[model samples]
Target: MAGQIPIIPFGPHATCTLELCPIEYSIFRYRPSLAANITFVVLNVIFALTHLVLGLRLKNWWFSGAMVAGCVSNIIGYAARVFLWQNPFSFIGFLLQIIFVGSAPVYYTAAIYVTMTRTVENLDVSLSRIKPKLYYVIFIVCDTGALVLQAIGGAVSTVSSGANAAGVNLALSGLIFQVATMLAFVGLLIDYLIRYFRDRPVASVATRLKLFLASLSLAILLILARCAYRVAELSEGYNGVLFHDELLFIGLEGVLIALAVVALGIGHPGLVFKDGQANLTKAYSPVSVPGGAESGVELVGK
Candidate 1:
């Protein structure tokens, strides 16, 4: 390709003309085998199809939407890499996947927020201190903040070849915001889980609830790992040591996130929400009150 780096794909790459660009240079860093890349592509595509069907079949819009967002980003990003494998100089393909896939985690995070809050509402909102609406407002705002920051970072780096300090700063800031949001979410989740499990009604799907909580935790862990990788990668600027490491990005961001998505799917609220077993009114009795009504408000205090 004219005006582009002459980079090789992964292993035993054929020699080319121009020098590799910093961004394209790492297209195969710590790189997986061609076989692994193929696996990643296939797995993500299958996940996307499954979510598309489930979202439509059950009308679980939020979970379905988030899964779709994640799968789409992963697929598009990998597709771009596939094109670059043909010719690593294709900057356009590089950007399309990098930006979309990098930010896709945010949507999954949002989906988790929706599901968890919905669980609270559908199960026992009165036991919780924070209302479901406020939880939505707060977490979604954080998600939007992360999205905008990452998007700006992508735009800025594109114009400046990923070395723009401003762009790196913005991206890092967004990631930091996401990390903080997740930490808070985890705290609330732990608190809620403790209270819920301790006082759970006989009707609650205990096993399913455990799975949902586990999946949500896995998602948070994946996002946290990705953010840490970004922070390390960007701290050194575009050409810095970790900046162009494709292998690291794939392992830390790609595989970690893909695992989280699958985990979340297994623990989806649909597992718990199905069959109306969670209906609260008929399951609880005022007479079973812990404090003989002297505690004033009915609380599932742990």
Candidate 2:
């Protein structure tokens, strides 16, 4: 009974053929087709190549690495999903992806956190008020906690099946926590950006900064939306609602994650031509020098 896909809860509430209720929970091991496996691999390949190029172009290994990690994890996770598509009971595949893909963004978020603060350091450090390092330190701490909870939750979810209420709860908690964390991070970033822009309103974004910020924001938004959807879908226990709905999972999870990877590519700071000499000379200073001193740097509040 568990191996087969079960009737959906919201449907007739009567006997339902698997066809009648596509959203029914299925205990059978989830499996993927050949096309799916290929898709995942392709995604990862593109991710690797894009990040490598970006790293070279921007000379920002940390940013490149974080983006690459997210993309690579996504690729691996999708591959695992494809495996599950082949064998629904492939717990190993599910676990590998659930752990890696779900938590990979922590690295990206940390990169964003670090990048923002570093931007301030490079710019008018005094205008930033808080030390750039502080954001990295604080957010990294929170991101680590989120990663732990999500990993634990994913593990619990895989084992629980329809009966693992506790695990489901844990997974839900982690998803919710992650969603909250991302939102907070986004808010913090927006705040900083607002301040930075206010102080340096006239300074156009350097090409690298534009790509870096764009890609980072898109990835964050995509992940945040995906997490929110997952939380909603999984809020009901496997047997109760659209617990094991595959289509929704593909749409919300697979597509969203894929988009994140692609967005990262487009937003890769690599598009800008890197001048090695300038980087060596400027080291870590802000790219532009806007209105040098004399006038007070004003704080622009939202």
Candidate 3:
């Protein structure tokens, strides 16, 4: 293994003596471009900081925590890529990107699950096909399963000497499961939307609800695209063409997730449910009576 690929620096490299180190290799061969990696790291850090400030300001404990976790995971994953740029054969760096970046989106998905439950509760849970509580219960549980599979797969592959079919399959199964969950969740969301609109006119809907739903939808699409790309990449094993294509990785995984994070921030539930208005289970609002007299109704009351 030590003599497999020539060691770097064109000399007796100190770090390449381990079982995982290549005899000779360039970081470029593994990581490709360094510029994009650095950009993602910086962007993630900025996004994390922004989420922290907003989360604190709005006191959205759950949403803020989930977003911050996802952002930090992105930052750490890209930082690992930076280390890989320095030493492409670094097993630790590879592991970091695989587990952190691969599993980070699960946190964001959890946040979305929570937000959907809250949305249904706020708008009209009776209008939804599934119960509001079931939203988080089902999706979060599925997300946890996906996260565990990916993490275990990363660990197994890290320890496995060469291309491990079992490890790759585990990781692929996790990605596939994630995509399936996303599809199901989206179907439910669309169903709820259809039911809600069918019962109530779009004009009667609150503007805040519209913005929040749109943002959540955008994030869902971005994450789905990123996860699908990962599934395809991992299905081919480590040495596959998609695995080596840095641009595709940056565009599909990094760029898509970055946009999703930003979209969530814009559609942060705090924007709508603020000042202890987070739980709208029985929220109500003022409505007009038959005699043009204003009356209070349970329609998103503040």
TM-score leader: 3
* Local distance difference test, candidate 2: 0.63
Which residue pairs in model 1 clash with each other? 29-247
Could you give candidate 1's per-residue lDDT for residues 1-302 as a string of tens digits? 68855544322333431254443444333222456556678888898898878777656777888888888888877777676665564556557766877777877888888887777876568767698766778998987888789788867865565657898788778877777888888788778877765644434434445566778778777777787777787677666777556678678877888888888778766555542223322222232235544111122111
How well does candidate 2 match the true structure, expressed as C-alpha RMSD? 7.4
Q: What is the TM-score of candidate 1?
A: 0.78
Instruction: Please give each candidate's TM-score.
Output: 0.78, 0.73, 0.84
Deviating ranges (above 4 Å) for candidate 2 = 1-25, 28-37, 56-58, 127-129, 199-208, 240-243, 269-302
Write the residue-wise lDDT of candidate 3 on 183-253 in tens digits. 99999998888876664556555565677789999999999999999999888876677877888998999
Clashes of each: 1, 15, 7
Ranking by lDDT: 3, 1, 2
> In angstroms, how far off is 282's CA in candidate 2?
8.7
Ranking by TM-score, best first?
3, 1, 2
Q: Which numbered prediction scores highest in lDDT against the true structure?
A: 3
